[model samples]
Target: MAVSYSFVAFFNSISSSYSSSFSKPSLGSLKPHYGLRVDSKNSSRRLVLSCSSSHMDSNSDTMDIGQTQVSSTAPFGLTMSEANMSRSSCKWQRVLLKVSGEALAGDRAQNIDPKVTMSIAREVAAVTRLGIEVAIVVGGGNIFRGSSWAGSSGLDRSSADYIGMLATVMNAIFLQATMESIGIPTRVQTAFRMSEVAEPYIRRRAVRHLEKGRVVIFAAGTGNPFFTTDTAAALRCAEINAEVVLKATNVDGVFDDDPRTNPNARLLDTLTYQEVTSKDLSVMDMTAITLCQENNIPVVVFNLSNPGNISRAIKGERVGTLIGGTRNSMAART
Candidate 1:
């Protein structure tokens, strides 16, 4: 059997120091807050109506109820509106969006086009407002391609790759600025340490930021040479346990052939990881594909030029090609 105790009684029994911090509210004023389990016996429990003071009185020895600062009402400190939105509309709780640097150029000669960046920012912001957690991995091909630039610049391949990583940092900071302009909170985390500018990549910290409704941007392409941002995105996705990887590109989706070169190339709506590797498809680099395949993470390849595609992908709509682990499964069914 279990014994029932009033909130005031329980506090007094435990320690007199907490008595002032928690007040026993009237039965009519009780809110549906969380409960405290004091009884150890296996038996039914009852609610205790206790409310915290609006402001905690200064106490050196007494501590706050939750040291982690997580909300009692909502998980991850999400606002009530965001929590409701997530519960009602979100198909994927967490998502990783991969944007190629060239897509941000958007037919402009400039390496980073403001108009294109804003367009992408707006879409991402809208999706975020829907209470979905979004992490972005942006490429740097618009500013530099290490493999190609190394041959012409007479620099070592490793040096060129480092420069390319810096370019990704630039793009990440640029996108962060754009997202912030519209009242979205963001954090730029680099793989390698650059504490003067951005936070170094920490798995738990990044996950906490995502839970708090702040978008996290991963830069520096895994902090290594010879690894594309695609691989970085896959690695980040796996580390963060994101549900799917949204690969935003200029084309609608993966095609049987190079769409730009082959006029009659057909867009493949769905593909398995094995089929992609077997056919030598260009969905992503083989390393990235293998990483995602090993982890059973699905990759959604879609057009960034089209508005609402990002949101559609989050909703699991039929907007683009889905590369999943299953064989012969269509996007609509998957």
Candidate 2:
């Protein structure tokens, strides 16, 4: 599946409208007054109706949930030159973005912050425009952590993990909403069955979605207890055949010691699986690192707080720690 004609039209409308239409609005509050018009004959194909201006007719229909309505002319905040970059500039054709639950919380440790999610959506939009297939695995730590809450709340580990899985679903829905509100087409797939809200996780269907240029968000943490989202991310990456795992975090990269505790901690630009495990460095849980190492999947740990870092990482720029990348590949990036 290639980029649909409707999506191309939507992108063109965005490029033109931003240059001539109304002033800029905050990303979080942006509501373009166009509705998603799906051709019944081709249900798989999605079309985004663009709004010419900020003002819209009162009777005009707006976006509906479960449907994609792209309202912004310049939703990604990228210049024409940047958006027009060739697909060859993107190093990896398909990649998995592992977003922690806390990343969506902004400066706090609870709740979903719209501004943070909006920023993430923008970065994803930019890459999708360049023909990259993105699959995301988001964590539930911001809303719930089974391991921590289990002991404190006196709930069994399995029950607590189920609650945490639900938290990931909530985050996934919020992220999908934010992305689709812009010009990006997104789908939410849960590990367990939840047909009413999202598609059940199917490997072939997920690959089809990515091939069709839709960003797929995998929620529910592998549909099992006792496994972390980090492990879920690694598993999904291997299942989807993602070239790399882009682990977006608050920290700049992996450090020799805990950066928070050691002010003099040094950032490690590159490391092998052996070094990460032998050093007991917390780049990811041992399970995740082992999965990636065995499957030959590289993981890039980077600071999500920095604007454009997502784009930079996808472009193979040296923005953060690269674990499991070969010397030749690391040199090329530098």
TM-score, every prediction:
0.75, 0.74
Q: Mind sharing the TM-score for model 2?
A: 0.74
Range of the 10 consecutive residues with the lowest summed lDDT in candidate 1: 34-43
Per-residue accuracy of model 1 over 65-141 as CA lDDT, tens digit each: 43444453543456766667675665687999999998988886799999888998889887777678999999999
1-334: candidate 2 lDDT, tens digit per residue: 7999999998778656653333444433545554334433454654434442344444544444448555343224544455446566677889999999988899884498899999999999878877789999999989999988886657999999999999999999999999999979899999999999999999999999998879999999999999999999999999989999999988899999888899999988899999999999988999999999999999999999999999888888888899999433543443
Worst 10 residues of 2 by lDDT: 19-28
Model 1 TM-score on a 0 to 1 scale:
0.75
lDDT score, residue 269, model 1? Answer: 80
Candidates' C-alpha lDDT: 0.83, 0.85
Which segments of candidate 2 are over 4 A away from where they belong? 1-85, 327-334
Model 1 local distance difference test score: 0.83
Compare the candidates by lDDT and give the number of the best one.
2
